[model samples]
Target: PISAAAFGVAGPIVNGVAKITNLSWTIDQIEVAHALDLAADKVQLLNDLEAMATAVPFLLPEDVQTLNTAEPVAQRPIAVVAPGTGLGEAFLTWNGRRYVAFPSEGGHADFAPGDSLQLRLLNYLAPQYGHVSVERVCSGIGIPNLYAFLRDEKIAEEPQWLREMMDQVDDIVPVIIQHAFDKAAAVPICVQTMEMFAHILAAEAGNMALKLLSRGGVYLGGGLPPRILPMLQAPRFMELFYGKGRFAQLMAQIPVYIILNQRTGLLGAGYAALALDESL
Candidate 1:
């Protein structure tokens, strides 16, 4: 709104509650109000993730997940996905015409990798990670460790140049992914690591969808998917997603979507507050 204000496209900033979730500082709410010249009660406290959750119902069909069928929603569940520091999972239950969404701390849940390769990954990661949680392995901050593991496993061979490139950087997951997609064959190891990581992600997403019985299909939301749309489109995701053996038939009926927009959470939060206000 700052730019809008300068252009006379918007009015003066009004009193509205804003929750600063990512801050470590103890927000003296009253102090912030005085500094911003706003009323104390005008500001509120909430997690940004929570705000993202609130946007669920307000999302356009494209913004949310829709299953394989053209028919209306049958007996099943709805799932929400948001990837930032870690992946966030949420679900909504429909009771007749009314629906309710609930939050979860699933990101902190244990990393359950399927098959022996992933088992090796967990074993390799466990010595350092002790108990591996999803966030510790799958996030922007955590992927470097995975890449290092790949280097050791000979899953992705990095030349002196790339090796030096990675050594200097703390997070190399993006580069690793790029290399995998671009030079997976030329760099056999990067290919394996990237493919394995893709499998792991698909496995995790499938686990979420199945456990939630996400009959509404699965929606992918996060910073990485938008950046890696083509890679995300790889058959590896679909292969792992439907690798549930006998249940594979059931899963195939589910469709998956990648959300490309970044403001989804903000939109969800605003919708939530507005609804809450109206209800009040």
Candidate 2:
């Protein structure tokens, strides 16, 4: 018989109930426990990023691609920054015996431009979204915003055929990314959009590294990173990451990796469940 259950939800958990972000579903601990015929205390819910964090320590070499080769400090804090439909952030801290994963809404935190172009992007978005968060300029949803800003500002010319294709698709991110990767028939605007996206992602990853002092490492997870591995592996991405004025050296020493395992969250949920059972 199952002694406990754990779920990694894409939202905040407050008093054991979670209202999924960008969705209308609500998950309650008591409701889940009753459905599974388990005691309420045996059910645990974690923010999706937190669940991803719990599995970081157990990842095999084959499960990740190293981006930074800095030696990790044993038992130091680790941070996870995932840019999927929205940005998700989490961290793990050593608690004497084991690392404890904690969830954060850092993705929703305010966006701070690191350069003049980014500052212009901020000003361009301010009128539309008064409180523009990093997610506004850095995730899957944010990709189109970048594309539109560039197109409108005439930074890059959007080809007529590409414009027609974008109009047909309900979600334009895949189209943009596809053209960006197509070397033979690459779209200039698409390329520019992805470049800006990569820059924002690197800067934010660096920000998290500094905030938590994650000497253990910083893991980049989610659907997008693996898909755009080439873009991320580019030199410019690391340059923006290491642009943290005084702490540039510290950022360089922090190991950065891309999580290639798609099942990491499931693996993490299993680990969380096992831990809950052991605590009983």
Candidate 3:
């Protein structure tokens, strides 16, 4: 019998009901309690990013890898950027006694191009999506969109073999990423797609760091980062991250890390449940 439980949902939880984004399900806290046979007040729901942010304080050293050497300032705001099925954003700041995580839908914000190539890509995508959001070119779904742009725009050639592989897979992101890292595959288009993905992700992360002034640190959490660790470590990613003209120096000093532990969201929910116990 469970005494307490917390869920990290993919969308905002309003009035104890979460209309899960990218999916059709709408979850209610009361329904969850009934399904689990737990007390009504024992269940807590949070945005996925909020849950991940909450788990930041509890992360063990081994759970993360430093992407940059900038030191963290104690008690300062912490920022989280995740690109999965959809991009997610959140932050945590001290509220005297504890760090409170705040969820945001910042991923849906307009995509801002930083270079000529990005500007061209934006023009290419604008017709299809009236408002190109950061999530449109930065998440799991975004990979294919970028891949298509590279292929159709003649930026890169999509070989017949790669086309066949993409045709066989329902989700083309993995196929593209796999071939991108496979030097033997000789798939230049796939590799270029991945590079573009890293560039956009890094740029967005830097944008978040600046927006929040997250001096505590910026944590990258998602399905993409861990799998593409090699790419993220390369100079290209860092170049884009610190390319903010006026803020380059400040960007270089903000600590950055990739969350290696995949269970961060669940762990955060567990911590939230424990907090409820203490409060009670």
**Top candidate by TM-score:** 2
lDDT of 2 by residue, 1-280 (tens): 8799999988889999999987999999999999999999889998888899999999999999998779889999999999999988999999998888988889889999988989989989999999999999999889989998998878889889888988998999999999999979888888889999999999999999999999999999988999899999998988888899998998999999999999899889888888888656
Ranking by lDDT: 2, 3, 1
Better of 1 and 3 by TM-score: 3
The residue pairs in collision within model 3 are none
Candidate number that wins on lDDT, 1 or 3 = 3
lDDT of 3 by residue, 1-280 (tens): 5778999988789999999877999999999989989878888998888899899988999999898889998888999999987898899999988888999999999999988988998999999999999999999989999999999999999889779877887999989888889967548998988889899999999999999889999999988899989999998888888889999999998988999999999999998888776556
Clashes of 3: 0
What lDDT, from 0 to 1, does candidate 2 have? 0.91
Clashing pairs in 2: none
TM-score of each: 0.76, 0.96, 0.95
Q: Count the backbone clashes (under 3 Å) in each candidate.
A: 4, 0, 0
Tell me the spans in candidate 1 whose CA falls farther than 4 Å from its real position: 1-23, 27-46, 61-76, 95-99, 183-189
